[model samples]
Target: MTIPEPGGPDALLWSEVPDPVPGPGEVVVDVRATAVNRADLLQRQGHYPPPPGAPAYPGLECSGMIGAIGPGVAGWEVGQEVCALLAGGGYAERVAVPAGQLLPVPAGVDLVDAAALPEVACTVWSNVVRLARLAEGETLLVHGGGSGIGTFAVQLGVALGATVVVTARAAKHERLRELGAAHTIDYREQDFLEEVRRVTDGRGADVVLDIMGASYLSRNVAALAADGRLVVIGMQGGRKGELDLGELLAKRGTLAATALRSRPTGQKAEIVRGVQEQVWPLVEAGRVRPVVDRRLPITEAAQAHRLVESSDHLGKVLLTLG
Candidate 1:
């Protein structure tokens, strides 16, 4: 897949490209499927660019079979089924992936569906579990609860014994609740702050997994418990906002933001290892599952992008290779 120029969904083109060859410590994958992510949309529109050393394509995660291994690589063989977290290039039929980023498809998960797991699983684990340190009996607030990341965070938070509160449109509330949200706030119909307060008995959320970014900064701070942590992972709502440092200081709250795509190879490897060890078991056991709204052929890349941008889907919209 190629983007001739940054613009709308039609900018995505399925054109022939040179195959990726693995370098040392890397592996080449014959991609079976790739899931669309918000980051891909940003890249397609020229608002975001792939990090240096990543491919020029738009995809961030894929599932496939190992096609080749580079020199100095070990413990993985050609023809092994795997899903991988990628910085870019997943939109293609073949992509070069860092060896450390490859994850075996969990038992009971179809190979194609596994493509949805890597990005969301790693992101939720790294930020919500590792950074936020959400504990049993605590409260978690997840914004955009109908999205791929939102759905994953909801299940994972619930599985870990935290009371999960989610913000989504009214139509998605029932499904989100079935996915383990303890409470669902219709972000369009109600004030999340008031609902959060009502649900928590005035205490506030212990941790907030935010995607709206600056637009929600103040309210997210207000929603925090004393000693709370706010993890901002996306900026869909805009990048700049005013924050009241005094209020944050008084609450003893911490604000941290992260983007997985730009991390160093080693750091990404660490997160991938952590996800394999800590999160995969839950997936294999069926405590969490991929929420795929629809699957489209890779050639329908533009349609897939439009689906994601519309935000009408309940979960991930996947693009599968022939």
Candidate 2:
């Protein structure tokens, strides 16, 4: 898919584009599926652009078979089933991916559904586990529990032995609990900060994985347990919010915000390796699995975007190729 001009979902044009050649340390994938992400929506609206040297198209992850391999890339062969975390260019029939970013499809995950794993797995693993060091017996608060990232974080936190609490719509509460959320707060009807306090008996969350950004900044800090860590990964709720440093200091809380697409290739490769080593086994063992709301043909990319924008989907909405 090519975007001649950035606008709405309709801006995505499934027009012809030149085939991508595999560069050194890269492999070309015959893309079978790609998952829609909030980053794709932001790029579609012209608010976010791919990093330098990335494809102009908008997709962050894809699953496929290796079609070609570039020089200096080893241990991977053509025709191997694989999925990749992409900086861009996944919204097409084929994409060239750095070899280090490719992962074998888990023993039981469907090829198409595997597309949902790379991005969410890498993001949650890197932010929550690697950076924040969410330990066993801690309390994890995940905002936007119905989102791809949100759902994955909830499950991963549970798998790591943490008490998972999420803020989502009432409609998604039951499903989230089924996914291992210990408590679910209906953000529309309940104040998450208050709920977190009540659920933890006023101790608050030990680690908060937030997506709402600036809008939740103050409350997120206030909801932190002593020595808590807040990792902000998105800005859906405005980009600017005032923080009460005094409160944060009193709580001895730490705040960190991160983005995946803009990370250097080496850093991304490291994250990919971490996911493969630490997370892939959980997936293969069925402790964690991809949650997909629905799959649509690539031609219905616009519809998929609209579905995601509407926040009606429970998990990821995937776009598939023939």
Candidate 3:
């Protein structure tokens, strides 16, 4: 998928492109599947661009087999099954990726479904677990719990023994609860702050996994418990807002914002290795499952983008290659 020019979903064109060749310490993956993300949508709309030296396409992660390996690459060979966290270029039949960013598919995950794991797993684990330090017995509040990252966080938070609360549509509440959300707030019909307070008996969340950036800044602070951590990874709801420093200071709340892409290769590799060591086992044991909403052929990349923009799907939308 190539964007002729940044515009909308219609801007995506599925045309043949040059096959990627591996650079030193890199490998070429014969991409079997790639999943859609909000970053991809932003890139399609001209708001985001690939990092320096990364592919110019819009995808952020992919799963496939190693087709070729560059000199100095080790522990992986051609024909090995793997998925990778990419800065871009997953929207093609093949993509060149750093060797260290690659992860072997978990023991029980299907090849194509593995495409959904890399971005979300690394994202949630790095933010909620590493940054926020959400521990057992804490209460976590997740916004957009039906989203890809939200779904992953809800389950992982639960698996780690936290009482999870989520804000999503009423239709998605039952599924979110089944996935271990102790409380679900229908954002459309309820106030998330009130719901969080009610669920935790007047104590707010220990941590908040927030995607609506500036728009939710004030409320996120309001919903935090003392010493709470709020990690913002996306800005779907506009970019500027006023912060109540006094409020944040009173709560002793910590705020952080991060993006997986644009990080140095060494940082990405570290995150990948952590995911492999920590999250992969939970996946292999069937404690966490990939929540893919639907799959479309790569040629219909525009349709996939449209579906994601609609926000009607529960989990991930994937684009499959031949």
**Per-model C-alpha lDDT, please?**
0.95, 0.96, 0.93
lDDT, model 2: 0.96
Screening candidate 1 with a backbone cut-off below 3 angstroms (N, C-alpha, C), the clashing residue pairs are: none
Model 3 residue 27 CA deviation (Å) reads 0.7
Error of 1 at 282 (Å): 0.4
- lDDT tens digits, residue span 1-322, model 1: 8888999999998899988889999999999999999999999999899999999988999999999999999999999999999999999999999999999999999999999999999999999999999999999999999999999999999889999999998999999999999999999989999999999999999999999999999999999999999999999899999999999999999999999999998999999999999899999999999999999999999999998898999989999998
Candidate 2 lDDT tens digits, 1-322: 8888989999999999999999999999999999999999999989999999999998999999999999999999999999999999999999999999999999999999999999999999999999999999999999999999999999999999999999999999999999999999999999999999999999999999999999999999999999999999999999999999999999989999999999999999999999999999999999999999999999999999999999989989999999
Shift of residue 316 alpha carbon in model 2, Å:
0.7
| Error of model 2, residue 189, in angstroms | 0.9
Worst 10 contiguous positions by lDDT, candidate 2: 1-10
Q: Please give each candidate's TM-score.
A: 0.99, 0.99, 0.99
Candidate 3 regions with alpha-carbon error over 4 angstroms: none
**Residue 243, candidate 2: C-alpha displacement in angstroms:** 0.9
Residue pairs in collision within model 3: none
Query: Candidate 1 at 172: error in angstroms?
Result: 0.5
